[model samples]
Target: MLTIDTCSSADVDRLLGLADQFLDDWAEDAVQGGKPDEDYEQRSTEWKVIRPLLVSAPTMFKGLKEIARIRQSSSDPVAICCAALARTALDGFLIAEGT
Candidate 1:
């Protein structure tokens, strides 16, 4: 439920939290004996977690989609990568806003 109007530090925090959780799930999935809920893609921005962001944060969404396309085409998928993309998108938005 991340809309442009309601976007704030909380949104950023949510993004970071999602990133951290994905990282943990990835680690557990890799280490064995791990029962992580939902798969990797599910936890990404592509899912319901930030569905509104798709329109609310179109810039970030488009960038993420492009990266996803590129990575899926060529590149090893990383658990923390989505989070990094989110961070980068935020950075880019901030820079563009001049604030």
Candidate 2:
């Protein structure tokens, strides 16, 4: 099992920020109504492959609860969006890292 204790709050926040950027870019691409940007396609492909595994993991609930807490505590829109993406990325990391 992955050790949630290994990650500090700042680290979690940083990861959230990056994930948010990814999501924002994806949204922008969708709004364009043209071909998806290469980066967005790559990230979306990665998400599709990893998402089902994450949902099946027993630790998902704890990660989700922690993300919800983070989201609720953040007043900034960017922070809230980031926190939501961090929820998925956290699970993805555990599976990808096999930790």
lDDT of each: 0.59, 0.66
Clashes of 1: 0
Top-scoring candidate (lDDT):
2
* Candidate 2 CA-lDDT value: 0.66
Task: Give candidate 2 misplaced runs (Cα > 4 Å).
Answer: 1-3, 34-99
Q: lDDT tens digits, residues 1-99, model 2?
A: 225545555555566567668777777967597765777777777876865554444355456667767888789898788777866777676686675
For model 1, residues 10-80, the per-residue Cα lDDT tens digits are: 56667767766766677677557465445554664345465455335645555665665565554455735
Each candidate: how many clashes? Answer: 0, 0
